[model samples]
Target chain A: MTVQEFYEEVGGDYNEIMTRLRTEERIRKFAGMFTRDESYKALVQCINDGNAEDAFRAAHTMKGMCQNMAFTRLYQSSHEITEVLRGKDLESAKQMLDVVTTDYNLVIAGIEKLLA
Target chain B: METMEKDTILIADDAELNREMIKFIFEEQYNIIEAEDGEQAINAIMENSDKICLMFLDLLMPKKSGLDVLRFMNDADYIDYIPVIMITGEATDETDEKAYEYGASDIIYKPFAPNVVMRRAKNIMELFEHRIYLERKLEKRTRQLRESREKLERNNEFLINALSSVVEFRSLESGEHIQRVKYFTQLFLKYIMKMYPQYGITNEQAILIVNASALHDIGKIAIPDSILLKPGRLTAEEFEEMKKHTIYGCELLEKFKQEDNEFYHYCYDICRHHHERHDGNGYPDQLKGDEIPIWAQIVSVVDVYDALVSKRVYKDPFAVEEAARMIMEGECGIFSPEMIDCFKLAKQELFAVTEGKFSFADVMVK
Candidate 1:
């Protein structure tokens, strides 16, 4: 997938962020940090460790990263899991982690393809 | 030097992308400090408390959360010092409420709008800067007011002492007489303060008493030179005339009294009642015991002591030992037992004054 295809698939306002930043260089720098993020991996680790608070922090951070990158599908999934963990409903949040992971993986694959 | 320095902004987030985006927006206008996690954010805030003017805190991080940082700021009283804007992925009522409760100045959703973030940060920084400016201005004004009040008090003291010297010169008493009386009054008052905490006689009151001692003989100014300057013993009529000096002094100071001028009250009491005996056998109204103001009692003992030890037209100067003996024996006038005791304790200092060694002006300097 090209950068255009990735933006189309994620349904993010790429052109808007670019215009707001006033330069493609800034957009590329933002995208570089986005590609290197480890919030999803940390979220999965916290879920496996059964640390509800840590899991909440991890999911919340992942959700924030997704929003900044304008990865709508992944942001929505992460937000759901973050809310569930915030409520201290660990079991429910654990059940939703798979959906979050799938969306996050898809975003990562699209970014990798675009960057390549 | 300070004007040459740049304002610092802190960006605290677990996501490098979030930090970079915010930094890119503010780097041109401010000096940026980045903290990768909540713990680092708190440490940065602690170390650079005076330098950092604004913060962009992420709601979630590894060691501590943005809410935790806010709580720390609240506990440490940094909430008002540094304005914080929480960066979050999604906006929820729950997170918003918690952030505000913890003292977050404002919250911004992620996907960081470059313009909105810059505008919000600038506005909050200016607001706090203005607040700090007003606070410093108020402090400086308060200091100025206090200094002027102190200066007025010092000038008032100088005028009172100048007037007292005029009365002394007119009465044919040595200028040193007023100095001796003032020193003896301070010595006695200091003992009273140390021994009697219940009286609540503050240092300020003691200074007023000493100042008023200068005017204790101001009524002598009103007497005729034929009577006041007489070197011989006075007739019964002439003695009665001399006794009226206390009444004259009180009336002279009466016109100067204002509601808040406590010094006038001290002067009035010392002038009218210093000649009164503690045994109720003394002149004027013949006020007895505590009926006479404490200031009057203090000045009364010092006046008689100075009179006995200083050479006058009517008599030769007595030794300090003889003066103390006469006062204790009630030769000059009956005094309070407590006053007599403090007088005895101050015998050495009083002797120094009579010998022209220690001066009351020294105490005034202190």
Candidate 2:
């Protein structure tokens, strides 16, 4: 769908949202997040450290963000993972994480389509 | 009125009471569906590809266990991004680990508080959403990187094949001839560059020169086969016709010589005067001495040496030592005195190379 049509469907003022999101404050804040949150780069770190708990915690937080933004596919996939994590199950959590990896790609494709 | 837009959760278990109680608790807040077994759970997940946001699955059920359901989802790739909360009467680390391996999202032991269950579900859902966002960001970056890499590989292949094909059509020989020439040219260039560091050619420059050498006979493609493949000596007219390759080769290369292109001049020079004599008796316009392009001259010596030693349709292969002696003699006075001396010094090694007694890799050693 056209970006404008998508915005209309979402009941949003497309141009206004774009302007607000592109403002210096938001871009700076977004860029600053790389350093501000150690958890933001958690995927690479989790794999490196072999700490499933940390990975699970990071995934839990990211899943929450996906839900809030209505990224249903990502939210659902990652949610299954944190559920496995809370149960103190590492192997299944890793498996669920794999699912997240696949669906996460699809979510990215959708986002790119929207941006275009 | 519009639908309330509530989250949909599936509760799958063999026990009707367990399903009913969970449904009753969540029905007000979430749209609920029920499945009685692993088979039913898999079916439910498949049916609700994206609509279902959460699942409460019982550990032991008829037909298939909860772990079985998880494995099915993981294997078939049927599960959506929804969170799964596995319900069990006896939750052990072994069972939990196995379930998780199958992609169970969460585990809740039976006879637990509804509030705790609800809270865990809410937390998991929140976390699920955020994880999706960062993942999407990373995926977008990865896809962009993949596309650019593919494009680069394609362009590299296109240019290499285009350049080599020009050499291929020049004679009756297969493309393998170019491959061998390119390989040996690189080996010799690498050896000399290392042994004589004062020459100041970088590895990259050597590689480009080797690539350029692939087009050494590109102009011969325009020559008539009667002249090119003629086994016997050529008449003066045929010889004169053959000499025009240098001019044709240069003119062919000139068409691509844009001002900003770094390699154009190198290519143009090599194509035009590779056949020029050091004493000024060779080619379309032989200026002689140090006037010949060094790259062309370098190629000329190697090309003639290889051509002499290799078996052709018309002539038997010359002995490597004989070929080396002929190159050293410089019958046409086409090569410089210094190059002839270099050929003499390197003759044994070149002989070994042509006789298949030395490897291309061995030749590359400084």
Candidate 3:
């Protein structure tokens, strides 16, 4: 479909979306809180210990913030990741988790952009 | 020096008899943590989060289903990795999948063989250690790389700050635009990275992408204020002139890279091509597909997305979905379908941040 047609289907709610981005300041602050060395390191440790549940959990919590703040891609992928774990799809969970890891850097990149 | 025994297991079962039998099976050989039910299991995990390692959970229990314990742990979101082995009489395919999805390392059937359980647990625990060893090595490499980038962050920051300010100065609009751009870019990048973390873009690369996002409009600095700040719609000529900012930003980044600096290489790619499109319709150079640097592709998408929703002298703010749909529609195939989807996902947050009035520190605090 053409850009205009696609926009017509998906762009129906621009004002609300803008408002959502504006409202995410607190959520962003919450994300920043996770940058702590101890907590961040601990989260990594949880993932490595085969506590896929814990790793998915930590990712879910962060993904939630990304979602509430409208970090759509992050929320979906993180959801996919943890969901795979939640569903017990070990191999796919790892692959999706890798996506979360790579995309997490993107989220951080986005956060850094916001800070700038 | 003796190698520290790293694997520790937590056994959570309602049956005292079962707990005792399993304890006896590995008693002196492995460090063990015991819990009566799901509640205690969770509490024990939270309390001794560090010391006790793997968990051996019984699926059917009095207080909580083995699933509940697994789900709670998945929800708690700890940084450390803890493997779990589910021991249950129910061995249905659904349960098996569910157990693995909930992060169980391995599932063990009850009425069990002690030797079999022990061997499997040991094997899974060994796999966990090997994964951690590789991750540790990667982390060490990352730490080293981050150190090296420290020297470049300062220079790149200076250049970006200077260029972004020049654009801001040219337009009498609040200088907050640069900061806003950075925030939007940061938000979008974080979303994308989390969806695809294999990029191995160091935290430093993240830092650089955000830094460079501000310079998206830096080339506007070279444009005349009369045209740059024009209250009316730009004529075709003026609009073409306006597009020069992308090239301007890229060249400035190129100048910084005169020394073959790795940091500048990143900055150069981002600055030069943030305007390129996925479908080959973007301007300045018309780079397309995988040929475009991913970060720049990300910035290009965000730049327009933000601009569409934000108030501009010539155009009214469009609805978020409309703006998102516009990006997704790809104007003329300018965005990747995958990235378009990614951008669409980020759109909700993008608009929220744009509309929300948050202090810099406030946004950064979390």
Put down candidate 2 lDDT per residue, A1-116, tens digits, no spaces: 55445434433334543343434333223222322333325743674576766676566555544432334555577678767766767777666667777766554444444544
Model 1 chain A weakest lDDT span, ten residues long? A18-27
What is the per-residue lDDT of model 2 for residues B69-93, given as tens digits with 9 covering 90 to 100? 8877778775436678887655579
Q: Write the per-residue lDDT of candidate 1 for residues B65-137, one digit (tens) a residue.
A: 7888898999999998899998877778999999988888899987767888888888988898888778878
Every model: iRMSD: 1.6, 17.5, 19.8
Best-to-worst lDDT order = 1, 3, 2
Residue B3 Cα positional deviation in candidate 1, in Å, after optimal superposition: 6.6
Q: Evaluate residue B189 in candidate 1 and report its C-alpha lDDT on the 0 to 100 scale.
A: 90
Q: Pick the candidate with the highest TM-score.
A: 1
DockQ order of candidates, best first? 1, 2, 3
Give the higher-TM-score candidate: 1 or 3: 1
Worst 10 residues of 2 chain A by lDDT: A26-35
Per-residue error for B325 in candidate 3, Å, reads 2.4
> What is the lDDT of every predicted structure here?
0.83, 0.66, 0.66
